[model samples]
Target: MSSNAHSFYYGGKFLSKVTDLVRSEIEPIIAARGDEFVDIEYVKEKSQNYLRIYVDKDQPGGIDIDEIAALSEEVSEKLDSLEPDPLPDPYVLELSSPGVERPIKNAKDWEKANGEYIHVGLYQKIDGKKMFEGTLKSYNDEEIELEIKIKTRRKTLTIPRKLIANARFAIEF
Candidate 1:
């Protein structure tokens, strides 16, 4: 099969085909171990292609290196046995926990993060601030409410969801 057939590209953007394949193959293995798949990325950086998979424990404490190593080995073995490889070129396979500060990519992420400290980056500045960090009070389809601190006082900021470019869990000092 042609390399193009294994890839999904349109309008000068490449979507995650190999990543999806890898995710599909490893999801069951991860779930059986009481872990959840957070995200996957297949990208070329500095002449090297990488397939990075992020996994998190379903329980509270989070996953560790040993779990990541074991999962990596299982995923590697499965990929090696595929008769027709999904990825045409060589790539490094990475598996690990999403860490303390994990990117919030979707509504599920936001929902899981309610009442947790988070940082949000906006595409356009709101109230002269492009970035905001606070406890995620609530979120909905239209907006999110964050309880921010201002000079020893607290204030709630309501930001439109459309204005946010990125969001992630945060560790406040």
Candidate 2:
């Protein structure tokens, strides 16, 4: 309902500008530290405003708590020094990993997720389902082979690449 330079209120929420600015400003700082920036969320939970930063590494071990702590300190200092700060005081700045159930966001993520238990979201329903959880068998630019559970049996589904809205690593219980 309001607008400012590169910032706007959508659905009575001011998310875009703040998240965008924060993302842009901190990406270089994150990259310089050899970390991959996953996402940032600026939102209110209960009476508190939170700026939650999600970060991860492509390495086998993934990012650890010490790295998160160090990054949090550096990012806090960087935000505090910004003139005309977009973030209000009394807001919580949190930095953490996206964890094991993280989304497969790009080609690299896809490559890393091969043969792993995963979830896929589709734009349209297939077999009366828009979402599926299974082990990823294989993938190409054209499609993916997913081995899913049906009743007491396992079945492989060949889904069109274009139908995937998103994919993520999943936990099978």
Candidate 3:
């Protein structure tokens, strides 16, 4: 088999295993620190692999750099002792807060996003629109209400929850 095909099947599976193991190792440490574990990804870019971890405080305000540094130290110590190491040597490990364009992954994200500008992706077109960027006024089990701009004018659009594929905090401009 060609290298591309071999990688297409095995590389991703191996990468997932690495990411999962890393998450299992670090998530408890993060939770014990009273923070939310947003996400973890292990990927290769330009011949180097990156183990990026996104975390946030459960309370109001962004997580501080000092806290992130301490957590990173703790996480490094834990991963260092893993019997079967999953990470590749020379991989870049990053621990930080999810910044301006963070994905909305849980209930707290939704609540924090209320009245904030965001990008919404849909599974199919809703009135010829498969996506929207607007102020998220509110959301519930059934749908979300967004105030969007139509040229100079603005209107509130009700989008069904079932149609949403992804939602994320976004910057306007």
TM-score of each: 0.83, 0.80, 0.81
Best by TM-score: 1
Which candidate would rank higher by TM-score, 2 or 3? Answer: 3
For candidate 2, which ten residues in a row score worst on lDDT?
A: 1-10
Give the lDDT of residue 115 in candidate 1: 99
Ranking by TM-score: 1, 3, 2
- 1 against 3, candidate with superior TM-score: 1
Looking at model 1, report the run of 10 residues with the lowest lDDT sum: 1-10
lDDT of 3 by residue, 1-173 (tens): 00111111232344335666677778899999998899887767798877888999866777999999999999989878876566536778889888879898678889989999999999999889999999999999889999999999999999998899889999999
Query: Which regions of candidate 1 deviate over 4 angstroms?
Result: 1-6, 9-16
lDDT of 2 at 100: 87
Q: lDDT winner among the candidates?
A: 2
**Clashes in model 3: which pairs?**
none
TM-score of 1: 0.83
Q: How well does candidate 2 match the true structure in TM-score terms? A: 0.80
Greater-lDDT candidate between 1 and 2: 2
The global C-alpha lDDT for each of the candidates, from Candidate 1 onward, is 0.84, 0.85, 0.82
Clash number for candidate 1 = 0
